[model samples]
Target: MLTALNNPRPAMLAVFMLLGGSVAAAASPTITVSWRDKPPYHYLDNGVPKGFLLERTQAIFAAAGIATRLAPEPQKRIWANFSHGATNYCSFSWYRLPEREAVGQYTLPISIDPPHSVLVSGAALARVKTHATLAALLADQELTLGVVDGVSYGPELDAMIAHSANQMMRRTVDTTSMMRMLSVGRASIMLVDREDWEYVHRHEPILQSTTRLDFPDMPPGLKRYIVCSRDISPLVMDKINQAITATGGAVRSSHGTEEERKAHQRP
Candidate 1:
């Protein structure tokens, strides 16, 4: 070994580091992945990726002899990197939106959630109590709706929001903040997954009195999927498809815990 005094040149050190990385990667070339923090599905647990979706996804990839490494990052960066082909990563717990599908490859359905549920404070609910359906509720312009900015609430809901964009209040953040808007009546109503609403409600006392509005006209629960960068090789995706088939399906279990179904009720 060279003595401590005999330092390597910077250029040589960089080349050596590059060679070391290549050698290490050849033995185990893991795909780096990440997704936004959407609770009860995917999120970072103590700075490490630890959701049920991660476990299920990892299991499928592992069984296919493919490994993955987590690169926790913001949601926007996930798409940006993929779009530029700067990196190859797959996002979890995504929904099938035509706009997104045009830009990336999507995996099979990850989970079938109940229809996006509308939420309103107890008092707000009473105002629209007679309006029992989505159409009727939308006709009443007195109440403003809340939504997370840039989120696609399914095609049908997206159309609805577009129709009432003037009456819609959007937050440039997660649904948790939108829920808060409903709690204080700053926003009269909001749309979210029943499971997601309940999860956030449990933690935010301001939302304790929130009620789910019944919308018979709404489509069935949204189908969650993983939208991968278009640049990902077909072989890797084919393997994932086979893994999905082998694992039965990606919607194996809810991820609030190892046994979330037993722990939380279907809302």
Candidate 2:
């Protein structure tokens, strides 16, 4: 099934009876909440949707007293819908990108990822260890970098990749395929989010012949947001932002600078 229904009746009743403000009407058009099949973040378990981000998104909508329909969609399809200005649609956990800003409206960050790590094949591990920074490794023309098509490694790394002269192996595949490619030495190295690396490392055996490496020049963790199409009202966005704040979601401060965010994040 492409869509899963969320029963908002009980929550709606509670909102009307106890929370008692002019929350969105229960009869409002149902917003479609779309997600890709990225496990530990969002995926279907026995036809029932489950994941940290999925649950948080449901909670936010429930708190906002808006009706929503959960839908599992391909990553490319989700972005394509936004580009075409699909109405009443929202997707969770996307990095804020410049080009994407023109297509969709973004809510406050709903989650954050740890810094990206490089997955190096056993054959390339020795060579990978020679580079002190990510820039040097990307400068190596002989080392082929495997990248997932249509995915961004955040603004900083995306900029690096665009300017690098390294041989690139772009695949329209998932992380598992990329990992398998590395294990078989088809690609020398690939960058993966630390969260994704941990999840795949536990559930898949492809990492047996690959090693995860970190570099000092790796960009700071990227903040993920719930992006909705243009038709979603500003009023609704304010409600969503309020719900995010209530659920302990983090937002960039007025200055909106990474340096300030990093300083505040320091332990």
Candidate 3:
């Protein structure tokens, strides 16, 4: 009788251990992500978050068995929160820089290339016959350039822009307002991502009259990434990268249609 009772106790103990292990494995961590209003890439549609990067990130996290909740906030505030480590938030389609690298860690390449071009009004395009580079475009003494505030143009190019001493304007507001300013002749040229310009043109007909200035080459060393706080576990970064690799290196755009790509490339 004593032997039989001891045998049952051991079996019961093993069952309890197995159940505890299952519970521990099932407790997947949930993380909060921050995003700004960048259309076709990240934005809110009808009060629900939607965009290519947002969707892809969600899919990757889900596949990795990591649950996530997205919180849409202003660009500046989101970065601030992430920087202070007050929030466990990640930002997508971010460019990697040394200064930023110090405070943040990035996943493997999310987008291999970033579309870059000089956007100008139709009237301005007619006046300016040619520009092969951003420097060449800035050579025009009378030309006023607009850039998004808080955006870094990489180290070398950023230094050039800062030293140029040219008449440059910046806005902390949305891209739509920048387009409006250009259309109204408030600025001669606006430096922007080609994808962003196309996104606005397709969705907002108000920018239909704008033209893309042909440059010899795109601004160099531009790539997008999934940025996370430096404090995040290295294991988490590895998991995210694994998920991204499994889905292919590039995140498919929600608005990346064959027709759109072809149309944007047209002369």
Candidate 4:
């Protein structure tokens, strides 16, 4: 049974009616949640939507007595759709930014943990350590860093990357592909969330031999949240936040190690 954020059945409608007077009372309000392929966060496996963040979102909405459809959309299209009010949707595990807030609302802090280190093959790890500051990191013309295309890492980082004339070479469509590229020496380093990296490392053979270069003292990780369109009612946002809070603030991994947890907890 695939979960959808659009198709509401009669039984679901009946349940909503029974719970009428709540914010979910609006005629089968189906929120088209935006999703992208970020493993251990949001991804499809054997045709089933399975990920920590996606499952947590579903659980949160269910707890709030809200029936929503979880539809997967491309990152850019999802933002565009929500911005135009063409859909009442939200995305799981998104970094909150001022530009995004102008067009959408956010659930309470999902993960305050900073992003983990960029996992690179052993050969590439040797090169990244040579660069100290971000400027030095960017100045290395020989290096090819990989970042997910639509991810935001706050304003300062965004500005820095935006101003960099040769930043395009550092971008990739998804993390898994980026990791593969790193393994094959197609790219030097792949930037990814620490928890996510471990998840992949445990499950994917290609990543098992890779080396993780943690910027423990540097700004690498991003605090993430669930975000919905600004057009969504304040009542809806409140319900979502209530559900998130009730669920203990964020998603708990079913398969994370103590080290990964500690790394995520690091400022």
TM-score of each: 0.79, 0.84, 0.82, 0.77
The C-alpha RMSD of each candidate to the native structure, in angstroms, is 10.1, 9.9, 5.2, 8.9
lDDT of 4 by residue, 106-190 (tens): 8897765444465666676667777554566656777776666777756656665676433344553667777777777776665
> What residue runs in model 1 are displaced by over 4 Å at the alpha carbon?
1-28, 250-267
Off by over 4 Å in 3: 1-22, 251-267
lDDT of 3: 0.72
Better of 1 and 3 by lDDT: 3
Best model per TM-score? 2
> What's the residue-level lDDT of 231 in candidate 3?
66
Cα misplacement distance, residue 220 of candidate 2 (Å): 0.7
Estimate, for each residue in 1-267, the C-alpha lDDT of model 1 and write its tens digit. 365337757667888999996676476546777777776566665876676666777777766666677666767777677667754667777778766777789877766677676787766777767776777777778888887887778888888877763377877887777787788888878877767776787777878777765466777777777667777788778877788778767463342453543332222
Q: Which residue segments of model 2 deviate by more than 4 Å? A: 1-24, 251-267
lDDT of 2 at 216: 76
Model 3 residue 233 CA deviation in Å:
1.6
Clashing pairs in 1: none
lDDT of the structure predicted as candidate 1: 0.72
